[model samples]
Target: MALLAQQLRTPLSTINALAQGLIRRADRLSTHDVQVKAEKIWRASLRLDELIETILSYTRASAGGIMLNPGEFHLSELIKRVCREQGGQEPDRPFHLDVKDVPETIVGDPILLEQALVIVVSNAMKYSRPDQPIDVTARGEDGMVRITIKDRGIGIPERDLPFVLQPFFRGRNAKKLPGTGLGLSLAWYILKLHGGNLEVESREKRGTKVTLMVPETNTTGLSYSI
Candidate 1:
């Protein structure tokens, strides 16, 4: 709770200060200046929205209110879309995608899958250096598909690796970073909800690799349960 409050305050303060500045300086500020500040405000609001949504997901899932709506969708298109969106935010960093071997279509909730991918990709960007690239690779394995996101960032500590998927669990090295620490936990939950699995392999100072495994068909036999 304290961590959540502290993280939320930073963005809220930015939004509040920028909004006030824009209103107060409307008469004197140049169009370009206004645009820049407005953009900052918009980005800060997005950060706040992500934080809120993550909290709600944690709460909802705990109460067994989360449900999966699986269906067939193009996996390549989804990967490309996520990379495009994330790349725009980190224009200096590159996202190399290799999904040719993955099935063209898979069965799952597209919206939820996208959210999980965003969490992983965004974390890769945030933890790694601006010059380092993010590698996303996917391939078929029997009836399942494996999507891997690898990053050349300060990897997780060996001791912390075991707890990385636990809610609100952050690595000692990542303590200085900006995050609520719920992303991996939520992403893991989403995968498990689809009868899939999330795996992580990392060596401190080397980098980290996250693999998401999902079936090509909705064989989980789960329904709209709350």
Candidate 2:
């Protein structure tokens, strides 16, 4: 699956570029329909690229090796970027972010964090109602950075919550959602590799909250209040 994903990346990139180029040349087109078609192609190509990457990440994780490019980044900025990307994909639903008492800098792989947060936030959006808001909050507590995402839609059953972190296991409430059931599992592994773990609390029909806890740097650790 990794090899297939690698092979598809080049062609998919080319396709995305071509679609964007066509959209840029829309003024030369004879009809509005042509422009719309080009735009749709561009969006679809982007979605396909994301799906391909997700599949590749899952495969690599299964092999017990997930590559990451580690660096120092602001946790709040990272959260905002992930939320923005997710919001773009889910315009129909409202998403909110709250950041408190977080350090401006943290050491970790930005790409990996982005991918992991994307998966979590995306899942929150997917399972929640269109009218309901997905709430994301981050704070520093007891030498750990805690980020929580809550969804006010169908919550995971108590029986299935334990298995939700297992690969390919989707909760009963999430069975109807469109997914390969690998997002949360992958996120859990990624967090674990970064000296963190996922904590989930849910009640059927009320809501679900997923808390991600990561150790803060020495500087940030000193500043921790709650």
Candidate 3:
């Protein structure tokens, strides 16, 4: 975790400096595109802040004392926010959000949900080709809100897929990728705490898809037990 934190800090600091510079010169920018770029920079810096917090939270949870602050929020909005946060740097590989079917709201910890989705989506972008599109879809069914993230990347080997969710475990194909291998594990824990499960489907050389199924409500039609 220390290594991961060190690796992330440098880039985050650079982004922070860049964002500040842009903000200082915001009035001098003449074009709409320049202003948009400045906003993206600032948002990206904020996302890095959230990611850093998430890493700390996961570390604290693994130490066995962290608790969630649950609430109600729109699943679609959460997904969009995570995608926007992570995809800001990649302007070429457009994110295609397909909300063909989904619920307006669900009960869960918004911060935790956002962190999990950020992990999955960040991994998707990291492994996928620059020109390939990343797909995010949400749907409500059988009292659950399911969010799926798919990327056209070098897929995991059949034998290694089962172990991918384990903490600090990296696959043969993932050795070259820059990651701590804690994202999936953290995501799994977050979903489990929300009474949800994570599912994966992939074919070697084709692509990979991860589906996070979170319960919409309890049997008594309440968000939490009394």
Candidate 4:
């Protein structure tokens, strides 16, 4: 509630102030100046939209509303598609999709897993530099499929690591970033629903590595879905 209240205040104040500015400077202001204020108002509205979406996801996760439908699909194709989706969100940024040792197929709730993967990728984009490649690597190990996303971004502080999975628990370095601090929490909930775990390793200013591990579907030695 506090975060929401704060988010409401910051953007609402900006829009109100900007509107007042336009009203006061109606005759004096140039078109370019009005354009700049409009841009800020638009940006704030987008931020509000993001905050509301985060709250909705968090509410759903808390209400135990998420369910999974596991089926077989090509992990490579899904990974590529997810990377493409996130990549499109930031056209100027580059992503490196490295699929090594990954199984050709896996059983999962494609929709939920796609959401989880995109959250991971989007976080990488938000923190890391445009020039720094977001490296996504997948592999199979010990009856589980593991995906690791490495970001050369402003890494999380050691003290913040334990609380990253908690909703609205922003890291020390992440305070400046525009987020509701629910991305990892939502991803964590979705992975748990799919019998998977999300893990992270990082050093302050060094970088962060997030690994999502899900046990391979055990169909009594049946390798392919019928």
lDDT of 4 at 17: 90
Select the stronger candidate by TM-score from 2 and 4. 4
Task: Kindly give the stretch of ten consecutive residues in candidate 3 with the minimal lDDT sum.
Answer: 217-226
TM-score of 4: 0.77
What ranges in model 1 sit over 4 Å off? 219-226
Runs of candidate 4 exceeding 4 Å displacement: 5-50, 218-226
Q: List residue ranges in candidate 2 displaced over 4 A.
A: 1-46, 218-226
Q: lDDT of model 3 at residue 104?
A: 79
Q: Each candidate: what lDDT?
A: 0.88, 0.75, 0.77, 0.79
Clashing residue pairs in candidate 4 are: none
Best by TM-score: 1
Ranking by TM-score: 1, 4, 2, 3
State the displacement of the C-alpha of residue 29, model 1, in Å, after optimal TM-score superposition: 2.2
- The sequence of per-residue lDDT tens digits that candidate 3 reaches over residues 25-137 is 87887788577766767655665665677567667767755456777788787787788867776777789998758877777788877888988998898888878899998
> How high a TM-score does candidate 3 get?
0.76
TM-score for every candidate vs. truth?
0.93, 0.76, 0.76, 0.77
Among these predictions, the greatest lDDT belongs to 1
Candidate 2 all-Cα RMSD: 6.8
Worst 10 residues of 4 by lDDT: 217-226
Report the C-alpha displacement of residue 192, candidate 4, in angstroms: 1.5
Estimate, for each residue in 70-138, the C-alpha lDDT of model 1 and write its tens digit: 888998899999999988876789888999999889888888889999999988888899899999999
lDDT-wise, the better of 3 and 4 is 4
Q: What does candidate 4's lDDT look like per residue over 24-55, in tens digits?
A: 99899899998988888876775576567667
